[model samples]
Target: MHLSVSCGIPLIAPCRSSVKLPPPSPGIFYGRAREIDHIIDLVLHKSPARVAILGPGGIGKTSIALTVLHHPDIQTIYTHRRFFVSCETVTTADGVVLELLTTFGLIHDPQQGILPQQVLLNHLQSLPGGILCLDNLETLWDVETRATEHLLTTLASFSQLTLLVTTRGSRRPMHVAWTRPFLAPIMPLSLDAALQTWDAICEVHNEYSIKLVHAVDCLPLAVTLLANLAESESSKMLWERWEHDKLEVLHTQDSDNRLSNIEFSIELSFRGPKLKDDVQTVQCLSIICMLPQGLHESRISLFADAYSQVLPKFRSSIALLQGLCLVYSSDDGFVRVLSPMRHYIQAHHPLPDHLLSQLANIYCDISLAVH
Candidate 1:
């Protein structure tokens, strides 16, 4: 008797190869349940062409992505075909593609005269389903838009593959959105959620810890860093010092997770042309930081001398700042900076005394008139 294995003409197989995914956070991940649920729905059920976990650095975007990747639903569907590419170190479009291909184990040999792109396509076709997480994508997306677009367009052709990109900026590549892309904007954790995280890190809690956490605006990265420091110092001392010198306290020596430092995290988010090159936006951030949180939108016109003309350029700068996650809008149309960010700007780029005086006078007049 003879036995034979029969298969379809264009043979297919479940993916067995392992890929280098982002390292899971060693600490407990708190908050972000709603985000995780929504993203899982989008990728596993809604079937969007692409999804981006867009937020500022240290907002736990990477941690959230890792959570979704390891979710039981995601794991069952994608079946270990998950891969990750850290776009932070990736400088070019080719570098981005090579990273993805290498993660999927597609590049067997460079001298084989086979294109890595084609290899990726072939492997993707054979897989039942797959998920790719592109972390820190703004490194390339900001400078190499056209090239990034082409790269996304090519990868997005595979309906079975889901691309989950994380970036500090809100803009999506022009190519990937054949349909509406699922955007999960990560905000800072709430006070209660932040307390839960703090509880895990600290053996004690008090007014000082609560105040310090709120002062950092409940940002997970900032909370984690300070909580670690709380191990050695009293929470009151940390809060007092942080209040006295926010940037000095936030500056960390950990080179691996630069986000451990509030200054480093914000600086990382503001890289590339649209942000680093735009002096007006930088100036606007400095001005906004000086005011109380949630400054009225109309008050931005006060920067008459800061711009060539305040209307057009100031508006553009604010929009750019919002896109870069350096600023955000409240429901009342008031814009505000995060606490740590406000602290970062105050330390690094305080407004001129004359401007500060002018702003104070304007506020004084407004308060008097309102009364």
Candidate 2:
């Protein structure tokens, strides 16, 4: 049974005239050609590509999704069937159905005795081989887990439909067999790509420009924000301000969008359901943020001893932080926060003095043992 919609209600054709257009292609995209190509291949070749682009906030998930939505081959295959739904403001499973209905130009008339989900499913059944892109789906998935799962499971059952989603954090919603060899969560851009993005914006390739990109760890949003600042503010001055201001230096006075403000973007993750009320996890993150070299996995036991009263399950706390994309394991086996995130944590949520002293003593003991 492709759809469960009853034959009693008249199936409505999608009103093309009222359909909303997808956002314009990201004008200055870089470093994601491989990801885009892989996604295209999955959607084009696979029976029903159920792909999720997962990552932390401000890491270019939306930009990559938008770029794929506008790809030439994707445009040729999906045509007007392509629907891009921004789930940033949506928080419920029903809300997702409504967004899809709105995107399809179908009016939900409760008086007609049709469930909105049925209306949506019926409409989708009418249009075969369509692609749906849900951007920033974490807003919905985090708050309404079971409901969202049921919704996605139902959607994935349509073998002719392709489902693509972008969400903050490292996990995709469960129950759906996402395409094999799942796409890894997006990471910070490479130095080369970061420099290209910087030069494109500021047009000044110098020592300071190189230093600026490195300072932000080549995060796309951070690079773009700082590059825009570099256009008017001298690189030297901006570098100095970065030392004092950190994320504040990347803010745009005129805009409140998370993408335009590094602080706001980090705050969203900090305030997400997983971390927002979890004091021990925040403190654990602060400890990692305080150490430039990061907290080694082996040393977590020592830190747990230091804060045993406050952080009884320190190992799980660190695991939660990593799962949330707040801290990552470095190539050197240390768990490190990105430079921009480190600065934000230090300035706004520094470790308590007593805990800092304990950590200092712990490190001092390690050094003494080494000698």
Candidate 3:
């Protein structure tokens, strides 16, 4: 008697070799598993909680949302059905509605002379349960839009789905969104965790105490990118290249999963037309950057000359920037940078000598306030 194993492809008692899969992105990618579990529970419960992963860029807001989607507990809860809209390519609100229509497996010509918002709301209402992860909402839609707010409230209060948002925006309409910690200072990587990250990024092992110190001062994105660079370059070379441009440390795209660490985040925080034509705004903000974090308004007022008549509204503008997640208040009473290392790198750019002297005056005011 002869027994044979039949297969689709010819199998001559073939030697099966294991196919190796690529490693995931580097950096200390530890997540808030407890928070993720809570989010899943919120989605599963009758009353859902809308989470807005709020923080500065490179602080890993999207990373948390993506991780939660893949969590085993979340998979069991959502049954692997979730809608993700990159929203990077989406410029208008109508684009969101179209993305939703496709995600829900509904077929309809977008050009059928029907606007997408109506189609989307109706379709979303029909689904029994779904979760929509809206990444980069600020970049995609107007924060001040009544339509956007209505859409958010409807998704939470009316639809079967929960909306998980990640943005640098404030937690307005408190019922609609909850602020998440992106700073990671509470559970920052231990030296061991950082070393593990280096090993994960490089082909061979390379770990040093000095490198770890630099990483401790770095945002997670920079740390991971550096770890990967260790594969090809000497540590001295990497550090020297990234020296003044500390943000340059975050440029490695090899760790695709770790894109949350992309250096472009620094630029995104700046270069908004919102700041155009506001020289005083620039000087005032730059002065704030120069001063220690969380300086008092009284001290800031001394720099009223920093912005002419505009300085009277410094409080409001600072609040606006803070709400935008470009900055955050500290427990120590200083408005420390939302991403400190990036701030230092950004603030390092050359300023007119006159401006630097003005900034020096602003700095002196803060010291006076301390005294």
| Top candidate when judged by TM-score against the true structure | 2
Instruction: Give stretches of model 2 more than 4 Å off.
Output: 1-17
lDDT for each residue of candidate 2 in 1-371, tens digit (9 for 90 to 100): 12254667687544333887789888888999989988988987886999999888889999998898899999998888888999888888888888888998888887767678888888777776888888988888878888887888888888888999998888889999899778988999999999999888887668888888999999999999999999998988888898777788887875668888888888888766888899888988888888879988888888888779777878899988888788888778899888888888888898999879878888898899999
Model 3, global lDDT = 0.55
Q: On a 0 to 1 TM-score scale, where does candidate 1 land against the true structure?
A: 0.88
Give the top-scoring candidate (lDDT).
2
* Residue 227 local lDDT, model 3: 71
In model 1, what is the error at residue 116, expressed in angstroms?
A: 2.6
Q: Relative to the true structure, how large is the alpha-carbon lDDT of every model?
A: 0.75, 0.85, 0.55
- In candidate 1, stretches whose alpha carbon ends up further than 4 angstroms from where it belongs are 1-18, 178-181, 301-312, 357-361, 364-371
- Which 10-residue window of candidate 1 scores lowest in summed lDDT? 1-10
lDDT of 1 by residue, 274-345 (tens): 877776677778878877866677766655434444334777778888888878887788898888888777
lDDT of 3 by residue, 1-371 (tens): 11112233221121222322212222346535555566666655634557666666665666677776766665676664666666555656566655555666555555654344554555555567766788777665443355555556666664456678776545443436442332222223445545555666764444352453354344555556677666777777776766566555555554333364554655554544555455545555665655544456555555555654545666667776666665656665566553443354345444457766767776677689789
TM-score of each: 0.88, 0.95, 0.74
For model 2, state the Cα shift of residue 289 in Å: 0.5
lDDT of 2: 0.85
TM value for model 3: 0.74
